[model samples]
Target: MQGDSRAFEAVIKSTERLVGQIVGRMIGNAEDRKDIIQDIYLNTFKHLPGFRHAARLSTWIGHIAYNTCLNFLEKRRLILPGENFLPEEEENAQASNAIESLIAHKQLTAILSEKLALLPPVYRTLIVLFHQEAMSYSEIGEITSLPEGTVKSYLFRARKQLKEHVLTAYKKDEL
Candidate 1:
């Protein structure tokens, strides 16, 4: 039992960040995120013995987190925000001072975050997995159960949409 507890602790330490990224991107509510993360960890512990070595441990854990979030969202009948999301006030805080370049960089990053929040959960997951986590298409496909082609296509669309939204928020003419 001590060995089991140590193994579980090691697993959580290694994969907690990956799980947090998935849960954070998919579920916006802080309270709901806590519940989802707890559920994910519980599920991971329950299923750990059954885990095969076919996939990377992080990828396997990520798959669990992604499915758990999907189930939670479905049960609650929640629809993640779509492209119609309004830009938050900070998005409009670009500066004109000597630090304009730095401020613009920060503003663009902020805009990307806001727009990313507006994407469908699938798109957000793909973006986070591919761009933020540096996972390849095959790895993402394994986690999402999407085909490699589908993963690539979805990632392309997500990037295109994010780019367009960011451009709209921070006008190209302003650069």
Candidate 2:
């Protein structure tokens, strides 16, 4: 990212999906989410010169993203409902669809998002980093400043609570 625009651009293209997934879940306002994404990249570029290979490059970028989002949250002092940041083109395609299964999938996604949004930011961040981002416990700990054991424990409780929430809602739906 330093002195090589091509390298920086390539990194941005490759990591766009990862950034989208992270910021999308945490920030409700699409505008703010977009701004935060830019901020993450800018911060990454600014600090690129000082980066040591203490962690994987992706992991380092993830740290920048994670911290940028937290700072945005702290400054805003507001948490909005979590959203599945589907690509705009895909969303447009889905909107034009007529298939039943597609409709059901959309509904399920919406419900799941609602349940996920109800979680506290910490648990939601843990779940996203662990499950959605496919990060290791150690990676998550590095980002969240939590010990690996604590990450495991919080993830356990988060999963349990989510499962209970889904089951109870489904039972009520059945009734």
Candidate 3:
């Protein structure tokens, strides 16, 4: 990635944040995020020459990352379930009040992520692209091969599903 120097660095600098955000939000494992990002750049470099003026270069890179993440998730579906999502060991160093708050926040985040993971990948993807990536409906549609209207519908449904899940989770906690 460093050999092409200026052009390559510029491409990475411009696109890396979105790639990281996409990969981080979509992929569950922190360890795998780095590898997936490296793979995206590698694929980008390999496919760069064939890239016609089809769409925005950033969108192209995002498509690559998005597809790669989906493939990664598909391949690891079985192994993922057995994985433990324990909170990090760093919590021990904090004060008791801070530790309690941290645990509560972590529990909420975990529940949300679990609920997010339950959505069909397409729905989850639209949510991530629209909300996390802040992409336009047309752009998300281009990446997903769906029409803009379809993208809007899916995003709406996905949000509704998440809302239901969050409320259900809180209700269960109350009981």
Each candidate: what lDDT?
Answer: 0.79, 0.72, 0.72
lDDT of 1 by residue, 1-175 (tens): 2239788899899999899999999998999999999999888888888887899989999999999998887787776434333333333333222334433657656667898987778789889988889999999998888899988887776776675565555555566
Q: TM-score each candidate.
A: 0.80, 0.76, 0.71
Q: Lowest lDDT 10-mer window, candidate 2?
A: 81-90
Tell me how many clashing residue pairs each candidate has: 0, 0, 0
Which ranking of candidates, highest TM-score first? 1, 2, 3
Off by over 4 Å in 2: 79-110
Model 2 alpha-carbon miss at residue 121, Å: 2.4
The residue-by-residue lDDT of candidate 2 on 1-175, one tens digit each, is 5858899999899888777777776777889888899999988888889989898777788777877887887787754223322122222332333334333544765666778876656677788888878999998888767789989987886766665555456646546
TM-score of model 2 relative to the true fold?
Answer: 0.76
Model 3 root-mean-square deviation: 9.7
Query: By TM-score, who's the top model here?
Result: 1
lDDT of each residue in 63-109, candidate 3, tens digit only: 89888987898787722211532122232222223323333655765
lDDT-based ranking: 1, 2, 3
- Model 2 gets an lDDT of 0.72
